[model samples]
Target: MQGKAGFWNLSNKLTLFRIGVIPVVALLLLSPGRAPNLVAAALFLVAAITDTLDGYLARRRGTVTPLGKLLDPMADKLLLVTALIFLIPLGRVPTWAVAVIVARELAITTLRGIAASRGVIIAASWLGKVKNLLQLAAANLLILHHPYFSIDPHRLGTYVLYLALFFTVWSGLDYLWRYSRL
Candidate 1:
């Protein structure tokens, strides 16, 4: 019933819900208020949960669809990209880092497209998953910028974000190397 499955399916619906949450998160984060940061982090956490749930349900229930596959990654990218971009103004993160992350993502995405057009399958690597987790954790920590329990979240998040950037570039290169083989 894969053909019968569409946007109405649980997996696809979760994907769409995640996508919808992106703008809300951005709006909440960007709003000038004391609570925006915490709110943004909470919304982002929910989105991340949806990302996990959707993928799990898709494979578990045999309801995978091309749309779900595309939307899921897109939602993740948008969430990460939005967070990084928004944080630039807040000075919690550097513009250069965001620029580098964005550039690598663009390059890898383009390479993936080219590889797909040439009938080459370049699946996500373990590094990519780690990069994502690092990015998500960094973003959340940065969002909660203030100190908590004698720990400077901003400083810690910066270090993690830098690591995410390292893996991002590494994974992009790996993907390009894969594409070149095709």
Candidate 2:
């Protein structure tokens, strides 16, 4: 049963807020110019930050809900995947990289569902968390795309993305190796 906070709790609200801002960020990125990209990066960062904030708030306030659990991951995938796809058209990210990232996400998600069906719970791994952080950082940098004040966001983002891809493959294999018995 949900607590008194119910579905409208702050944490869930933040998750919903993250979902709500995704379209706005996408549209901002679609616009051409430094200002739009910068704004999109800022908004994307806010949404990503809320991902952590919402989880922390839910746990700390005892307001974790089934809906929250369901929406949080969905919101994250939508935001990150959308950003990556948008970045491709902007010439900010490579198609093959996005394909690998998407494939890993789908494979892991499918793996978890299969495990769940057999009465097993494959909990999130630390490497998975690190991958999320790396992806978020890369997406923000790649979205920003251009150099600013002696900082080249695209090159740096590409470097971070390589690390993210490494982690993504490692974590996916780790999950499969550990949970294949299920």
Candidate 3:
């Protein structure tokens, strides 16, 4: 039991670490000049890896906490939004795409806050999960500038972004409708 508790504690600490790294990764990505883009991309990749590992460890170890629940999504949103915002002006991503994604994130976050305040916990929908995956892929591709082993990174990123946007809109409306009915 002591060992289990220790493991769980470590898992929670890792989750916190993942949340804390987002800003540093964002700042690295935001730095001027192309030389650091690769470094920024690597940092972003590390941050993304931490995101996955933390969640997996939490579930596997049964270490989920209210703080984890809140911080996980919040960190994800911050990282993705910061990446989109920084990349837009760099000409690496489209402004409209970032706008749509940001709007969706904001709407869903607001709805989640409302639901939490009412003592209702909303599980992430399948569509929402897919949207997240696509968004992550898009961010990664955009950050790397889409180097191709015969595939166009920009076009693929654009396609994934659109898919993410579609799901984001759908999921947002679904949450809103569900909340209204409740």
Q: lDDT: which candidate is best?
A: 2
Candidate 3: lDDT over CA atoms?
0.75
The deviation in Å at residue 150 for candidate 3 is 3.7
Question: How many clashing residue pairs, candidate 3?
Answer: 0
Candidate 3 per-residue lDDT, tens place, 12-83, comes to 676667667677766767677555666767777777777778778777877767667667777778878888
Which digits, one per residue and each the tens of the lDDT, describe model 2 over residues 1-182? Answer: 46579999999999999999899989998999999999999999999999999988998888999999989999999999999999998888999999999999999999988998999888889999999999999999999987999999999999999999999999999998998887
lDDT (tens digit, per residue) of candidate 1 on 25-68: 77877787548877888888888888778888888888888877
Using alpha carbons, what is the TM-score of model 2? 0.97
lDDT of each: 0.84, 0.93, 0.75
Q: Give candidate 2 misplaced runs (Cα > 4 Å).
A: none
Worst 10 residues of 2 by lDDT: 1-10
Off by over 4 Å in 1: 1-5
Error of 1 at 141 (Å): 0.9
Supply candidate 1's per-residue lDDT for 107.
Answer: 86
